[model samples]
Target chain A: MSMLEKLQPIFREIFDDESIIITKQTTANDIEDWDSLTHINLIVAIEKHFNIKFALGELQSLQNVGEMLALIEEKVKKNE
Target chain B: MNEYKLKDMIVGLTQSFSVDITNEMMDLFLRLSGDNNPLHIQREFAKGMGFSDRVVYGMLTSSFYSTLAGVYLPGKYCLLTGIDVSFHKPVYVGDRLTITGEIEFISESTGQVEMKARILNQKNEKVSKSKIKFSLLE
Candidate 1:
Protein backbone atom coordinates (compact mmCIF):
# COMPACT_ATOMS: atom_id res chain seq x y z
CA MET A 1 0.00 0.00 0.00
CA SER A 2 1.08 3.58 -0.56
CA MET A 3 2.24 5.65 2.43
CA LEU A 4 -0.87 7.79 2.34
CA GLU A 5 -3.07 4.71 2.25
CA LYS A 6 -1.21 3.28 5.22
CA LEU A 7 -1.62 6.58 7.07
CA GLN A 8 -5.36 6.71 6.55
CA PRO A 9 -6.17 4.03 9.10
CA ILE A 10 -3.95 5.65 11.70
CA PHE A 11 -5.66 8.99 11.25
CA ARG A 12 -9.07 7.37 11.38
CA GLU A 13 -8.19 5.53 14.57
CA ILE A 14 -6.77 8.60 16.24
CA PHE A 15 -9.72 10.78 15.34
CA ASP A 16 -12.18 7.93 15.90
CA ASP A 17 -13.85 8.60 12.55
CA GLU A 18 -13.53 6.19 9.72
CA SER A 19 -14.95 8.61 7.19
CA ILE A 20 -12.11 11.12 7.60
CA ILE A 21 -10.33 11.61 4.26
CA ILE A 22 -6.92 13.21 4.20
CA THR A 23 -4.91 14.81 1.43
CA LYS A 24 -1.63 16.66 1.19
CA GLN A 25 -3.37 19.91 2.05
CA THR A 26 -5.12 18.58 5.15
CA THR A 27 -4.16 20.36 8.33
CA ALA A 28 -5.22 20.71 11.96
CA ASN A 29 -7.72 23.40 11.00
CA ASP A 30 -9.49 20.87 8.80
CA ILE A 31 -10.34 18.60 11.73
CA GLU A 32 -12.44 19.51 14.73
CA ASP A 33 -10.51 17.45 17.30
CA TRP A 34 -6.97 18.16 16.12
CA ASP A 35 -6.07 20.42 19.00
CA SER A 36 -2.66 20.40 20.69
CA LEU A 37 -3.50 17.50 22.97
CA THR A 38 -4.83 15.34 20.17
CA HIS A 39 -1.95 16.48 17.99
CA ILE A 40 0.50 14.92 20.43
CA ASN A 41 -1.56 11.74 20.55
CA LEU A 42 -1.57 11.58 16.77
CA ILE A 43 2.18 12.05 16.66
CA VAL A 44 2.74 9.30 19.18
CA ALA A 45 0.42 6.98 17.32
CA ILE A 46 2.13 7.67 14.02
CA GLU A 47 5.55 7.07 15.50
CA LYS A 48 4.46 3.78 16.99
CA HIS A 49 2.77 2.65 13.80
CA PHE A 50 5.79 3.41 11.64
CA ASN A 51 8.38 2.39 14.25
CA ILE A 52 10.12 5.73 14.07
CA LYS A 53 10.62 8.73 16.31
CA PHE A 54 10.05 12.40 15.64
CA ALA A 55 12.00 15.20 17.27
CA LEU A 56 9.94 17.93 18.85
CA GLY A 57 11.52 20.44 16.52
CA GLU A 58 10.79 18.28 13.50
CA LEU A 59 7.20 17.87 14.59
CA GLN A 60 6.82 21.65 14.96
CA SER A 61 7.90 22.31 11.37
CA LEU A 62 5.35 19.98 9.82
CA GLN A 63 2.42 22.16 8.79
CA ASN A 64 0.31 19.66 6.87
CA VAL A 65 -0.18 16.03 5.93
CA GLY A 66 2.07 16.48 2.93
CA GLU A 67 4.97 17.55 5.04
CA MET A 68 4.26 14.70 7.43
CA LEU A 69 4.14 12.22 4.57
CA ALA A 70 7.47 13.44 3.27
CA LEU A 71 9.05 13.07 6.71
CA ILE A 72 7.63 9.59 7.14
CA GLU A 73 8.85 8.52 3.73
CA GLU A 74 12.31 9.83 4.49
CA LYS A 75 12.41 8.13 7.88
CA VAL A 76 11.03 4.82 6.61
CA LYS A 77 13.66 4.77 3.87
CA LYS A 78 16.48 5.46 6.32
CA ASN A 79 15.33 2.54 8.49
CA GLU A 80 15.34 0.06 5.60
CA MET B 1 4.31 50.13 24.84
CA ASN B 2 8.02 49.48 24.79
CA GLU B 3 9.20 49.90 21.22
CA TYR B 4 11.18 46.83 20.18
CA LYS B 5 12.23 46.74 16.58
CA LEU B 6 13.15 43.48 14.85
CA LYS B 7 16.81 44.44 14.99
CA ASP B 8 16.64 44.63 18.77
CA MET B 9 15.82 40.96 19.31
CA ILE B 10 18.75 38.56 19.49
CA VAL B 11 19.12 34.93 20.35
CA GLY B 12 19.93 34.11 24.00
CA LEU B 13 17.80 36.97 25.37
CA THR B 14 16.18 35.59 28.51
CA GLN B 15 13.56 36.48 31.14
CA SER B 16 12.32 34.88 34.35
CA PHE B 17 9.34 35.57 36.62
CA SER B 18 7.43 33.80 39.36
CA VAL B 19 3.77 33.30 40.18
CA ASP B 20 2.14 31.87 43.29
CA ILE B 21 -0.68 29.48 42.53
CA THR B 22 -3.55 30.17 44.88
CA ASN B 23 -7.02 28.75 45.39
CA GLU B 24 -8.64 31.93 44.14
CA MET B 25 -6.48 31.84 41.04
CA MET B 26 -7.51 28.26 40.37
CA ASP B 27 -11.16 29.08 40.84
CA LEU B 28 -10.95 32.06 38.53
CA PHE B 29 -9.09 30.03 35.91
CA LEU B 30 -11.62 27.22 36.17
CA ARG B 31 -14.47 29.66 35.62
CA LEU B 32 -12.73 31.42 32.80
CA SER B 33 -11.72 28.27 30.94
CA GLY B 34 -14.98 26.43 31.60
CA ASP B 35 -12.80 23.37 32.19
CA ASN B 36 -14.46 21.81 35.20
CA ASN B 37 -12.46 18.61 35.05
CA PRO B 38 -12.80 16.72 38.35
CA LEU B 39 -9.04 16.28 38.55
CA HIS B 40 -8.72 20.04 38.98
CA ILE B 41 -11.86 20.90 40.98
CA GLN B 42 -12.55 18.00 43.32
CA ARG B 43 -9.93 17.00 45.86
CA GLU B 44 -11.45 13.59 46.51
CA PHE B 45 -11.56 12.84 42.83
CA ALA B 46 -7.97 13.93 42.50
CA LYS B 47 -6.91 11.75 45.44
CA GLY B 48 -8.80 8.83 43.99
CA MET B 49 -6.84 9.41 40.82
CA GLY B 50 -3.56 9.38 42.87
CA PHE B 51 -2.94 13.04 43.46
CA SER B 52 -2.68 14.62 46.91
CA ASP B 53 -5.04 17.43 46.01
CA ARG B 54 -6.90 18.86 43.08
CA VAL B 55 -4.30 19.37 40.38
CA VAL B 56 -3.99 22.79 38.80
CA TYR B 57 -4.94 22.92 35.14
CA GLY B 58 -1.91 22.55 32.86
CA MET B 59 -3.12 25.37 30.59
CA LEU B 60 -3.32 27.64 33.64
CA THR B 61 0.36 27.04 34.25
CA SER B 62 1.27 27.22 30.56
CA SER B 63 -0.42 30.62 30.18
CA PHE B 64 2.57 32.12 31.96
CA TYR B 65 4.46 31.58 28.69
CA SER B 66 2.26 34.27 27.18
CA THR B 67 3.12 36.65 29.99
CA LEU B 68 6.79 35.94 29.41
CA ALA B 69 6.60 36.53 25.67
CA GLY B 70 4.26 39.53 25.73
CA VAL B 71 5.32 41.47 28.84
CA TYR B 72 8.96 40.58 29.34
CA LEU B 73 11.12 38.98 26.62
CA PRO B 74 10.21 41.00 23.57
CA GLY B 75 8.15 43.18 25.96
CA LYS B 76 5.50 45.47 24.51
CA TYR B 77 4.93 45.77 20.78
CA CYS B 78 4.80 41.97 20.93
CA LEU B 79 2.21 39.80 19.24
CA LEU B 80 2.11 36.19 20.49
CA THR B 81 1.19 33.88 17.62
CA GLY B 82 1.69 30.32 18.85
CA ILE B 83 2.73 28.14 21.76
CA ASP B 84 3.64 24.45 21.95
CA VAL B 85 3.85 23.06 25.49
CA SER B 86 4.27 19.77 27.27
CA PHE B 87 3.19 19.22 30.87
CA HIS B 88 5.68 17.09 32.78
CA LYS B 89 4.30 17.20 36.28
CA PRO B 90 1.19 18.21 38.15
CA VAL B 91 1.04 21.72 39.62
CA TYR B 92 -0.56 21.72 43.03
CA VAL B 93 -2.27 24.63 44.77
CA GLY B 94 0.11 27.01 46.53
CA ASP B 95 3.03 25.94 44.35
CA ARG B 96 5.23 28.86 43.50
CA LEU B 97 6.23 28.54 39.87
CA THR B 98 9.18 30.32 38.31
CA ILE B 99 8.73 30.66 34.56
CA THR B 100 11.73 31.28 32.35
CA GLY B 101 12.01 32.10 28.66
CA GLU B 102 15.08 32.22 26.43
CA ILE B 103 15.26 33.16 22.80
CA GLU B 104 16.11 30.12 20.69
CA PHE B 105 15.77 31.31 17.12
CA ILE B 106 14.82 34.45 15.24
CA SER B 107 13.45 34.38 11.71
CA GLU B 108 14.81 37.41 9.91
CA SER B 109 12.18 37.36 7.20
CA THR B 110 9.15 36.90 9.48
CA GLY B 111 10.55 38.82 12.46
CA GLN B 112 9.25 35.92 14.54
CA VAL B 113 11.26 34.47 17.41
CA GLU B 114 10.99 31.09 19.06
CA MET B 115 11.55 30.98 22.80
CA LYS B 116 12.40 28.01 24.94
CA ALA B 117 10.18 28.24 28.02
CA ARG B 118 10.06 26.30 31.27
CA ILE B 119 8.18 26.40 34.57
CA LEU B 120 9.91 25.24 37.74
CA ASN B 121 8.06 24.67 40.99
CA GLN B 122 9.25 25.79 44.42
CA LYS B 123 11.22 22.57 44.80
CA ASN B 124 12.97 23.31 41.51
CA GLU B 125 11.18 20.55 39.65
CA LYS B 126 10.23 21.24 36.07
CA VAL B 127 6.46 21.17 35.80
CA SER B 128 6.18 22.11 32.17
CA LYS B 129 8.17 23.23 29.13
CA SER B 130 7.23 24.97 25.88
CA LYS B 131 8.36 26.63 22.71
CA ILE B 132 6.62 29.95 22.26
CA LYS B 133 6.69 31.88 19.00
CA PHE B 134 5.82 35.56 18.69
CA SER B 135 6.44 38.52 16.44
CA LEU B 136 7.25 42.10 17.26
CA LEU B 137 4.48 44.37 16.06
CA GLU B 138 5.89 47.13 13.92
Candidate 2:
Protein backbone atom coordinates (compact mmCIF):
# COMPACT_ATOMS: atom_id res chain seq x y z
CA MET A 1 0.00 0.00 0.00
CA SER A 2 1.09 3.58 -0.55
CA MET A 3 2.25 5.57 2.45
CA LEU A 4 -0.84 7.78 2.35
CA GLU A 5 -3.10 4.70 2.38
CA LYS A 6 -1.23 3.39 5.40
CA LEU A 7 -1.57 6.76 7.10
CA GLN A 8 -5.28 7.17 6.42
CA PRO A 9 -6.41 4.70 9.08
CA ILE A 10 -4.18 6.31 11.68
CA PHE A 11 -5.85 9.67 11.11
CA ARG A 12 -9.29 8.10 11.10
CA GLU A 13 -8.65 6.26 14.35
CA ILE A 14 -7.10 9.26 16.10
CA PHE A 15 -9.96 11.61 15.20
CA ASP A 16 -12.54 8.91 15.99
CA ASP A 17 -14.15 9.71 12.67
CA GLU A 18 -14.32 7.12 9.95
CA SER A 19 -15.29 9.72 7.35
CA ILE A 20 -11.99 11.57 7.50
CA ILE A 21 -10.33 11.89 4.11
CA ILE A 22 -6.94 13.53 4.15
CA THR A 23 -5.07 14.98 1.21
CA LYS A 24 -1.92 17.02 0.63
CA GLN A 25 -3.70 20.30 1.43
CA THR A 26 -5.45 19.01 4.52
CA THR A 27 -4.30 20.91 7.61
CA ALA A 28 -5.01 20.46 11.27
CA ASN A 29 -7.58 23.22 10.95
CA ASP A 30 -9.63 20.96 8.72
CA ILE A 31 -10.23 18.42 11.46
CA GLU A 32 -12.42 19.33 14.42
CA ASP A 33 -10.56 17.17 16.95
CA TRP A 34 -7.04 17.98 15.76
CA ASP A 35 -6.13 20.17 18.71
CA SER A 36 -2.72 20.36 20.36
CA LEU A 37 -3.21 17.19 22.40
CA THR A 38 -4.50 15.24 19.43
CA HIS A 39 -1.67 16.67 17.38
CA ILE A 40 0.74 15.11 19.84
CA ASN A 41 -1.21 11.88 19.73
CA LEU A 42 -1.12 11.95 15.94
CA ILE A 43 2.63 12.38 15.92
CA VAL A 44 3.09 9.58 18.44
CA ALA A 45 0.79 7.27 16.55
CA ILE A 46 2.42 8.05 13.24
CA GLU A 47 5.87 7.46 14.70
CA LYS A 48 4.82 4.10 16.02
CA HIS A 49 3.04 3.06 12.85
CA PHE A 50 6.01 3.93 10.65
CA ASN A 51 8.71 2.85 13.11
CA ILE A 52 10.35 6.24 12.73
CA LYS A 53 11.19 9.03 15.16
CA PHE A 54 10.90 12.78 14.86
CA ALA A 55 13.51 15.11 16.25
CA LEU A 56 12.83 18.17 18.41
CA GLY A 57 11.84 21.19 16.27
CA GLU A 58 11.46 18.92 13.22
CA LEU A 59 7.67 18.60 13.63
CA GLN A 60 7.31 22.30 14.47
CA SER A 61 7.80 23.00 10.79
CA LEU A 62 4.97 20.79 9.59
CA GLN A 63 1.87 22.72 8.49
CA ASN A 64 -0.22 20.23 6.52
CA VAL A 65 -0.69 16.62 5.55
CA GLY A 66 1.51 16.97 2.46
CA GLU A 67 4.52 17.98 4.51
CA MET A 68 3.92 15.13 6.96
CA LEU A 69 3.65 12.64 4.10
CA ALA A 70 6.84 13.92 2.56
CA LEU A 71 8.66 13.70 5.88
CA ILE A 72 7.53 10.14 6.40
CA GLU A 73 8.54 9.17 2.87
CA GLU A 74 11.97 10.65 3.36
CA LYS A 75 12.46 8.97 6.74
CA VAL A 76 11.24 5.59 5.55
CA LYS A 77 13.40 5.75 2.39
CA LYS A 78 16.43 6.72 4.49
CA ASN A 79 15.83 3.81 6.85
CA GLU A 80 15.57 1.39 3.94
CA MET B 1 10.14 9.48 45.59
CA ASN B 2 11.98 9.16 42.31
CA GLU B 3 13.52 12.41 41.06
CA TYR B 4 13.92 11.31 37.46
CA LYS B 5 14.18 14.08 34.91
CA LEU B 6 13.04 13.70 31.31
CA LYS B 7 16.59 13.23 30.11
CA ASP B 8 17.11 10.53 32.70
CA MET B 9 14.35 8.27 31.40
CA ILE B 10 14.82 5.81 28.54
CA VAL B 11 12.44 3.41 26.93
CA GLY B 12 12.27 0.01 28.69
CA LEU B 13 12.99 1.40 32.17
CA THR B 14 10.81 -0.44 34.69
CA GLN B 15 9.58 0.00 38.24
CA SER B 16 7.59 -2.37 40.44
CA PHE B 17 6.14 -2.38 43.95
CA SER B 18 3.54 -4.18 46.02
CA VAL B 19 0.48 -2.92 47.91
CA ASP B 20 -2.21 -4.64 49.97
CA ILE B 21 -5.93 -4.00 49.61
CA THR B 22 -7.39 -3.64 53.07
CA ASN B 23 -10.77 -3.04 54.70
CA GLU B 24 -9.69 0.49 55.58
CA MET B 25 -8.99 1.13 51.90
CA MET B 26 -12.42 -0.14 50.94
CA ASP B 27 -14.03 2.04 53.63
CA LEU B 28 -12.05 5.10 52.58
CA PHE B 29 -12.97 4.57 48.97
CA LEU B 30 -16.67 4.13 49.84
CA ARG B 31 -16.72 7.20 52.09
CA LEU B 32 -14.87 9.43 49.68
CA SER B 33 -16.18 8.19 46.33
CA GLY B 34 -19.67 7.11 47.41
CA ASP B 35 -19.40 3.91 45.35
CA ASN B 36 -21.65 1.69 47.49
CA ASN B 37 -22.02 -1.06 44.92
CA PRO B 38 -23.08 -4.26 46.70
CA LEU B 39 -20.67 -6.21 44.51
CA HIS B 40 -17.80 -4.31 46.02
CA ILE B 41 -19.10 -4.15 49.59
CA GLN B 42 -21.15 -7.29 50.34
CA ARG B 43 -19.46 -10.66 50.12
CA GLU B 44 -22.79 -12.41 49.98
CA PHE B 45 -23.91 -10.24 47.11
CA ALA B 46 -20.66 -10.92 45.28
CA LYS B 47 -20.92 -14.67 45.91
CA GLY B 48 -24.46 -14.60 44.63
CA MET B 49 -23.13 -12.99 41.46
CA GLY B 50 -20.59 -15.84 41.12
CA PHE B 51 -17.60 -13.84 42.37
CA SER B 52 -15.55 -15.58 45.03
CA ASP B 53 -15.89 -12.63 47.40
CA ARG B 54 -16.60 -8.95 47.58
CA VAL B 55 -14.55 -7.57 44.74
CA VAL B 56 -12.33 -4.59 45.41
CA TYR B 57 -13.37 -1.53 43.50
CA GLY B 58 -11.61 -1.53 40.12
CA MET B 59 -10.81 2.16 40.42
CA LEU B 60 -9.34 1.65 43.88
CA THR B 61 -7.12 -1.11 42.57
CA SER B 62 -6.14 0.93 39.52
CA SER B 63 -5.51 4.04 41.59
CA PHE B 64 -2.03 2.70 42.19
CA TYR B 65 -1.28 3.70 38.59
CA SER B 66 -1.17 7.24 39.99
CA THR B 67 1.48 6.23 42.48
CA LEU B 68 3.34 4.32 39.76
CA ALA B 69 3.52 7.45 37.63
CA GLY B 70 3.80 10.23 40.20
CA VAL B 71 5.98 8.62 42.83
CA TYR B 72 8.09 6.13 40.90
CA LEU B 73 8.49 6.44 37.13
CA PRO B 74 9.27 10.05 36.37
CA GLY B 75 8.37 11.09 39.91
CA LYS B 76 9.03 14.75 40.49
CA TYR B 77 8.31 16.34 37.14
CA CYS B 78 5.55 14.02 35.98
CA LEU B 79 2.33 15.60 34.75
CA LEU B 80 -0.24 12.96 33.86
CA THR B 81 -1.66 13.14 30.35
CA GLY B 82 -3.94 10.12 29.96
CA ILE B 83 -4.57 6.50 30.86
CA ASP B 84 -6.26 3.52 29.17
CA VAL B 85 -7.02 0.64 31.50
CA SER B 86 -8.61 -2.81 31.35
CA PHE B 87 -9.60 -5.01 34.29
CA HIS B 88 -9.06 -8.67 33.53
CA LYS B 89 -9.60 -10.48 36.84
CA PRO B 90 -11.70 -9.67 39.87
CA VAL B 91 -9.59 -8.32 42.70
CA TYR B 92 -10.79 -9.01 46.23
CA VAL B 93 -10.15 -7.25 49.51
CA GLY B 94 -7.02 -8.47 51.36
CA ASP B 95 -5.27 -9.29 48.11
CA ARG B 96 -1.68 -8.19 47.73
CA LEU B 97 -1.21 -6.55 44.35
CA THR B 98 2.10 -5.97 42.67
CA ILE B 99 2.12 -3.05 40.29
CA THR B 100 4.68 -2.95 37.52
CA GLY B 101 5.30 -0.25 34.91
CA GLU B 102 7.68 -0.27 31.98
CA ILE B 103 8.48 2.70 29.79
CA GLU B 104 7.20 2.09 26.26
CA PHE B 105 7.61 5.32 24.38
CA ILE B 106 9.01 8.81 24.86
CA SER B 107 8.50 11.87 22.68
CA GLU B 108 10.99 14.56 23.51
CA SER B 109 9.29 17.17 21.35
CA THR B 110 5.97 16.60 23.06
CA GLY B 111 7.51 16.07 26.49
CA GLN B 112 5.46 12.92 26.73
CA VAL B 113 6.14 9.41 27.94
CA GLU B 114 3.92 6.37 27.62
CA MET B 115 4.26 3.30 29.80
CA LYS B 116 2.58 -0.11 29.93
CA ALA B 117 1.55 -1.20 33.43
CA ARG B 118 -0.01 -4.25 35.04
CA ILE B 119 -1.31 -5.25 38.44
CA LEU B 120 -0.74 -8.87 39.43
CA ASN B 121 -2.18 -10.69 42.40
CA GLN B 122 0.05 -12.62 44.82
CA LYS B 123 -0.81 -15.75 42.87
CA ASN B 124 0.87 -14.11 39.85
CA GLU B 125 -2.41 -13.72 38.01
CA LYS B 126 -2.84 -10.48 36.13
CA VAL B 127 -5.78 -8.53 37.47
CA SER B 128 -5.42 -5.39 35.35
CA LYS B 129 -3.40 -3.89 32.55
CA SER B 130 -3.06 -0.30 31.40
CA LYS B 131 -1.27 2.17 29.23
CA ILE B 132 -0.42 5.41 31.02
CA LYS B 133 0.85 8.64 29.47
CA PHE B 134 2.44 11.59 31.23
CA SER B 135 4.38 14.69 30.34
CA LEU B 136 7.51 15.91 31.99
CA LEU B 137 7.39 19.47 33.31
CA GLU B 138 11.12 20.01 32.99
Return the TM-score for each candidate structure: 0.64, 0.96
Record all residue pairs in model 1 with backbone atoms less than 3 Å apart, i.e. clashing. Answer: none
Residue A57 alpha-carbon offset, candidate 1, angstroms: 26
DockQ of each model vs. true complex = 0.05, 0.61
State the displacement of the C-alpha of residue B132, model 1, in Å, after optimal TM-score superposition: 0.6
Off by over 4 Å in 1: A1-80, B1-3
Most DockQ-accurate candidate: 2
Candidate 2 global CA lDDT score? 0.92
In model 1, what lDDT does residue A16 have? 88
CAPRI-style grade of the A/B interface in model 1 = incorrect
Q: Ten consecutive residues with minimal summed lDDT in candidate 2 chain B?
A: B104-113
lDDT of 1 by residue, B1-138 (tens): 245667888779878999999999899998899999899999999999999999999999988888887788888878787688999999999999999998877655335567899999999999999988777787
Over all chains combined, what TM-score does candidate 1 have?
Answer: 0.64
Alpha-carbon deviation at B50 in model 2, angstroms: 1.0
Clashes of each: 0, 0
- Superposition error at B77 for model 2 (Å): 0.8
